[model samples]
Target: MTDGSIQQTRLPTRTVVLHIGRHKTGSSSIQATLRHNQAQLLQRGVLVPKNLPPNLSGFFSHVFSRAPEALKFNVERGHGRQQAQKHGNRLLERLAHELEAFTGNRIVLSGEEACALHPDEVAQVRDRLGPVLAPAGQQVDFRVLLYTRDPVAYASSAMQQNIKKNVKLLEDHKPVVLRKAPGWYQRTHAAWAGVFGADAVEFRSFETACAAPGGLIGDFLTAAGIPPEGIEPQRANDSIADEIAGFLSSSHVPKLPPDQRGLWSAGFDLSTADQEILFAIRGSKGGLLTASEQAGLWDAVAADMRFIEREFGITYGAAQTAGAVPFGPVFMDDLKAALPRLSPPVRRGLLAYLRDRSAPGDPGQLQPEGI
Candidate 1:
């Protein structure tokens, strides 16, 4: 038998709920809900860090002294790694210290990228956070909250997301495969559990949660241990309009300022007609996935799904019917509207410019000779 005192169990004066997003898992909605209800959560003895940017660095800093290279990839790929890292340590440290100093509240830090980190990186986070609470005479408990969608459904949604983002690389894509298997989830969860312990982790199905008694927002709040009363369902990071995506893809490409250039560049590689066809196929609601060449792409995704389930413990749910969301027509309309405004030569020039810019060049050739 053990003593029942707070000190005996190392009960955390602060509770850190890390919502490592598995991407395309309604992470934005969850983050938005938490942000909107920060005050209410605090009133309930829960401290969701407000100062921290909705990114992973702050959470990662709690696990490691320095940012990992993979984190840099996430940053370079426009995941806000650098910006998040910039204030990660300060934000987490401040939250931890403040919660300890002021109220015996639990600090909940939620971000989806936390789920994508490598296992070793997760371990570093656990160690870093563990010591901070120990020395402060407070217990630190790490809890991971995540949602899994049916593999096919997740893939379908994810593909739409990729198309919206103009992402070109099919090789790095993991939608159909993730739906078919659980490897991605298993790896991500394993990373967190390895560091924080399995008991500290919790998993929920987004599909089920969404269809639960009150819907996704309600389910999320309940899962986070918050009462659902008076909680407004705050939707965050919803998809941009298809016209907006088209405009961004065209006008916003070459002219993006230096700081923002990298983001636009990371979209689809349009060098090949097949790539364009794939993009169109994936982007369309009723787009066929079984064209002669496209079959290979689908096969790849299927293989990936198998790998994901085998590795991550993620399971695919029933397939959801795809709907005509009007993104494609809107994108096309936006493209046409933008095209007539530019002269033929100017259009050709723009295409050439983008082609040249996206093409591989030696590091020494970063700046052209005659500027």
Candidate 2:
């Protein structure tokens, strides 16, 4: 019944889904799913571009390529909106050109870093995207999906991640307490929704998403109105064991020289044994949660749950009722399984690699003659 060119029919000229990630959630899982399902999406008359590159590098490259002045202030003064209008215009042009060249059915550009933009930046983004999508005779629908978790749990998990990446936060010095202040979600989501309208913004709890029987990917697909079946489940990035070790080694424990510390205070490429050591260290340091603290944290999380539901108008209990699963058990199993496979030499080599990578200047300078 529809009469349109194959280009128009196969490709959605107007609508583009921009998944702006609110970090420490299941953003990785969503990105992985999209990457894995690129072909399947195309078959469904959707195009998720693999050539879009990863993270802010490619995005900034595309933006700065057209407007070189955009990065000048951002790099020098750490101010992002130095040349907002020019940058926005250039970005729109680049995206339009790329979309036109793509032969696939639908075009999906995803980057978690996009969530870092301010309100003004988001407006700029919308303005840029509008022109790019207009030429294709497609209506642009900007969908902002954010996954929130219990603040206590999120902080703990995030600390672990920071240790792995060797990042240190000022709050690491403060006692771990559940504060009820507005967080990244409030700032970032509110900004985008202000520009894009509340209906276009969807927020889900990461805890619920990962709890599903089919895991994070299934939950996201269901939310996005995409069929979950037959999509390959790629391994989620940033292992939990590494995350724990990174946290303990970085923030909870005494500080080390920058070179010795993990990038995010989350150590990289940690094995199962490393996680066990980390847990043991935490126990020794009285860092393991007391039963009462755990209960209190959960209570705080419950409060956050209520808040998100009221604010975002989304449901979180569905996946929980359907036999919700916890990630701790899976993490423990992975650590245990990895132990026997790591010989002493391999462990030493890994340590050296981590140190060398984290070290300043050329790590080769510190390397032994034989190495």
Candidate 1 lDDT over residue span 238-323, tens digit each = 44332223323453333334465354344432334323322332223322122332344434356445544564454553333332
Off by over 4 Å in 1: 1-14, 57-88, 133-135, 166-182, 240-371
Model 1 clash count equals 24
Question: Per-residue lDDT for 94 in model 1?
Answer: 66
The lDDT values for all models are: 0.54, 0.54
In candidate 1, what residue range of length 10 has the lowest lDDT sum? Answer: 362-371
lDDT of 2 by residue, 34-65 (tens): 87878787787666655554343336333523
